[model samples]
Target: MSQELPTRLLLIRHGESEVTVKQIIGGDQSCTGLSVLGRQQAEALGRRWAEGHEPKVDALWSSTLPRAYQTAELLAASLGDLKVQMHPDLVERRPGQADGVSFSEFTDQFEWTGDVHPYVPLAPGGESQSDFFHRTGKALYELVHSNPGTTMMVVCHGGVIDVAMRVLLGLAPAAPFLLWTLNTSITEFLTTDKIGVWRLVRYNDSSHLSGLPTHTDYE
Candidate 1:
């Protein structure tokens, strides 16, 4: 009999960093640590997942960003730390010179007119949408294909998650920005040998933010 693959990944995006709260640009450069509320969000997710899920995870993976790293640490603690792995492929898109700008500034500088309201155009020296998609596919290929356990958790950014879905769903590589990932939200997809038949398990599961004063809302 063929062995059953793992229960799919519990993919999560890190909590809102200070950059998110401030509405500042945080791409690959100049990281923005999580805000106080973001830390709380991380705690909230950890509590819920630890208390709610039945079987524990076989591994915990996170991007190298400070916000993602911290979120992963908190989650690892709650999950009892079967193992923690850091993967550089999971890093956010490098916005290059636009990393420290405000949203208004970003639009004013770059004439972005996509149907997707918040899709940022790559400023000079920054990564284009296609390039970002390429990087995202690379990340998922490593994470999803490399692991075959019953379950695993990978904490990453919203952009990475968006591109990953597009790739897994066999949609065009670029254009769409996000799959509704709120601050500290979760997005799940199940894969099989059949390829392109992945299951869309969940998206933006943020019930833990019902009462938080500083909760963030993403499109």
Candidate 2:
């Protein structure tokens, strides 16, 4: 009998964005893409892969957001120029009316006294925590099943990666601890022979950015 090949998924968070610097809610409508440092971070990761520091990526995907798409583009320039496939479902949590609002303004408008409900949207018409988790979980499941036995690179947001971890590890929707995924960091997962079994190959790997300036924002 032959051993079944495991599916490999590499989740990479987009580099620091203008929204992080400006402290604004960056939905698809307000995202202006990567900042100067952000571009450099993405370039650093690209160079790492170009130098054979990571495995060869069989496929490339990114969220529809500009920041994610731009990061994927930068990586592709070094990763055999792989065409990046955009997926709306892989985007960060939808901010809705808070798309361009600053953090201060958001707090002034909607103040939460205690732990917000999972079903309550952070912003008007936005996706609740539960909704975002479900969307990302479903998208990740589809991605893994659609391309079995292949290594895929997905450029998205930190929140999406967090949801991916929970979904793969069978954790609760409400995260007990923060992942703090760094900008342009890589989180890898591999599927096992048993159904719904996944192994965490690595998390928050940004070795290429050892000397590069990076941000600590939670976006």
Candidate 3:
């Protein structure tokens, strides 16, 4: 008998969105759809995947946000119309009262002290960095256990990817970790036989965006 392959996860950040372009603070309330460039990036990602850039996945999952949903739809077009399952748990961290505020105002009001203390929330009624960690961890853990031994693709926000990395590597939620995942970028991981262990295969891969103008906004 042959040993079964470990579960493979392809984590993709959603394409550019109106909120990201306009420099607005969405906190999870930013439902604005993808911009024109965002659409092109999504299509390019699809072409890349269809051209053997990524393995055929058994399931597709996406955050409930409109930007992520639209991205998943566009990418699915190139992957044989892969059905996408929406997961609210995969959505970005909420900024609560700061949801629709301007970026400057949001930053002025909320202290980004997570690097010093991970339990700090962005604002009153918002989720703390620690809260984000457990939520993303639970969601990914369940996603993998439910779909054991298969490739899964999850389209979500950049912050979610950040949390996912921490969750997979058992890092402290509020640690000073900084990295950028470009629009429609790919981050790959694999579940190991050692229970609750995961291996990172790649991070922030945007080769599909080559020769294309890239978005320089948040994640």
- Score each candidate by Cα lDDT: 0.75, 0.89, 0.83
- Backbone clashes under 3 angstroms, per model: 0, 0, 0
Candidate 1: list runs displaced more than 4 Å: 52-55, 110-121, 175-178, 192-196, 214-219
Model 2 poorest 10 in a row by lDDT:
1-10
Most lDDT-accurate candidate = 2
lDDT of 3 at 1: 10
TM-score of each: 0.85, 0.94, 0.90
lDDT of 2 by residue, 1-219 (tens): 112766889999999898888889999789999988899999999998999868889899999999999999999978899999999999999988889999878887777454778898888889999999999899999988878878899999999999998999888888687879999999999875547588899999988889876564544
True-vs-predicted CA distance for residue 52, candidate 3, Å: 2.9
* Candidates' RMSD to native: 3.6, 2.4, 2.8
Per-residue lDDT of 193 in model 3: 70
Q: Which stretches of candidate 3 lie over 4 Å from their true place?
A: 1-3, 109-117, 192-196, 216-219
Could you tell me which residue pairs clash in candidate 2? none
Model 2 alpha-carbon drift over 4 Å, by segment: 1-3, 216-219
1-219, model 1: which lDDT tens digit per residue?
Answer: 113664477778898787876777887676767878888999999888778563467788888988898899888878886456888878888788888888778887776454332244377677766677787788787666667544778888988888777776777764534366787787777665434356778888888777887555532
